[model samples]
Target: MSTNTEARLFSPTTIGAIGVVNRVAMAPLTRSRADMEGVHSELAIEYYRQRATAWLIISEATNISREGRGYAFTPGIYTDEHVASWRRITDAVHEAGGKIVCQLWHVGRMSHVSLQENGAAPVAPSAIQADEQVFLESQTVERPSMPRALETAEIQRLVEDYRNAARRAMEAGFDGVEVHAANCYLLEQFIRDSTNKRTDQYGGPVENRTRLPIEVITAVAEVWGADRVGVRLSPITRAVGDTPLDSDPEGTYFYLAGQLGKLGLAYLHCVEGQTRGDNGAGDFDFKRLHAKFGGKYIANNSYDRQMAIDAAESGHADMVAFGRPFISNPDLVARLRLDAPLAEANRDTFYGGGAGGYTDYLPLADAA
Candidate 1:
């Protein structure tokens, strides 16, 4: 076990304008504990507060607008009421001496009509259906409804939704925001050529295909200076609905990272491989992608303690993000420093639930 002074993971680092106490970050995990109105429940305050030891907490995938939702009980950031609800959670995290950022999300075609407004079809870059399923209000999984191609004119409105969500994140007292452009979501739908078959400015070649995501990021950067914003990307993840990899994962993502780097954003959070699976699932070079960006990198996806320590010591990553571990070990930073055994989280209680597996897990000290 490495002492606090021995582990480079305990060292402080600056992610853009935000100075973190350590290189450990809590990746976004969808708990589906929000109310029907998309407001986070009161239990979330303690849930996040318990994990305050992390250098940064990237909030779960949050909806930017009503049309952005794909799963039930996920939080939204569009309404004033939503802002007020999130403010309390942010206050709790801050009071506990933690920094957090909201992850703006739009599920695109990965939605069911039952979860949509007026049973409307979900919108996507093309009118194609995904091979995935979404969780409905009843906690049952159902196939996604067919989607309609987004009109070129509506593209600007989607950008506006992201901009407005960033504005609301500011109002809610978050330290910063992460644009969720990964995992076959709305942004990724437009980014990958497999799903996007449009002939408009947002389709075809790599340049045109990445237009919408770049524009959305630009709009978000306009609200919170580029230095305070971060973009999350998964170059070859087929996690949701078996979304196929881009025709050229290396070419597409390297180009995208270079473009984002030019915007002077804080950092690029890359899911190294499959979301909850393999870390070396593909042949793409993440180091080259990081080099292409020429900025700080937060390496994620199944990173264990030694891997994280090595990444930090070798300067391969500025920070490392842990997902499921954070759910079972709120004092994960302390455990890592002491080399303590981590508790496993209950898979059944991972989704919509009360305070069972959410916050009942004891810290190392309490467990001892």
Candidate 2:
């Protein structure tokens, strides 16, 4: 086990059933490029195939059902058509020697009424309105709609929905599925004390707050097996639609990570440091989580090539996930290895766009 920079960053490793040639991963990114029918296009196939060099590529946060949709043109995995559409993308990645996993998501209170069913209210652990607005095809609106508190029965159904979606993902040819428990979505909304004010067994104490997420994980694991599953958590980020930081983030996530560890997950993706800037947000120690998690850590958020090398060489993370870099640099893994200049990503075309900024970025040779 050489601890040199290249050795640490490029060494092959196994994460559960998936094998990686390097420690570079592609973080799940929402581009809102799916069709109106919630199906991925051929463009998505090429988009993923171009970035196939990543050790693992986590697909964008995909809705599990119509009720789970929070933004326009985001793909879903709950329908037969959706499964078929995703097969093309998965087949392309596999053909290009890549491993990919779909991220199961439910927006919960972070949704707007326009994206809901028949202008219905979104659902959450409680009826609290998130201080966040959702993105629409037309425009980004403010003042997210007030969500209805999910009944105990509906909560059970949501867990079942996750199971079904995982099954569909496997059918769609994904290597596995990653539970979207981070980024102030449905699971995070329940895990955080500030949003979950329920008096039932699914709220109040940390155990209660963690209940829904655990159930969802268990159901998804039952479908994909624990070894093929991964969980993502953002312990300190509060920028997703003004999601508030937890009063006891350290305690809440440590306990959660320890619990997830018991399930034998493939990896735990932790979004640490500042959301958009450097890794100097606060006193939060992601290394402590790596220890408690007792599994491979995929560290994400604002990581450069050197920072990624440092995290792996120091045993802080087994892999580093890059989002924005992958957007502009299709050959990101090669570029990082050679320390080549990365192409600048056009933020304007990041979401709700066509291939102008999606698959149009040239590789190193073309750029040269």
Using lDDT, give the best candidate's number. 1
In candidate 2, clashing pairs total 0
Which residue pairs of candidate 2 clash? Answer: none
Off by over 4 Å in 2: 1-5
Candidate 1 weakest ten by summed lDDT: 1-10
**Predicted structure 2, TM vs. truth:** 0.97
Q: What is the Cα root-mean-square deviation between model 2 and the actual structure?
A: 1.6
lDDT by residue (tens digit), candidate 1, 50-81: 99889699999999999999999999999999
Task: Give one digit per residue, the lDDT tens place, for model 2 in 83-140.
Answer: 9999999999999998999999999888888888788999998888888567875756
Model 1 spans > 4 angstroms off: 1-5
How close to the true structure is residue 300 of candidate 1, measured as C-alpha lDDT?
A: 95
Give per-model TM-scores.
0.98, 0.97
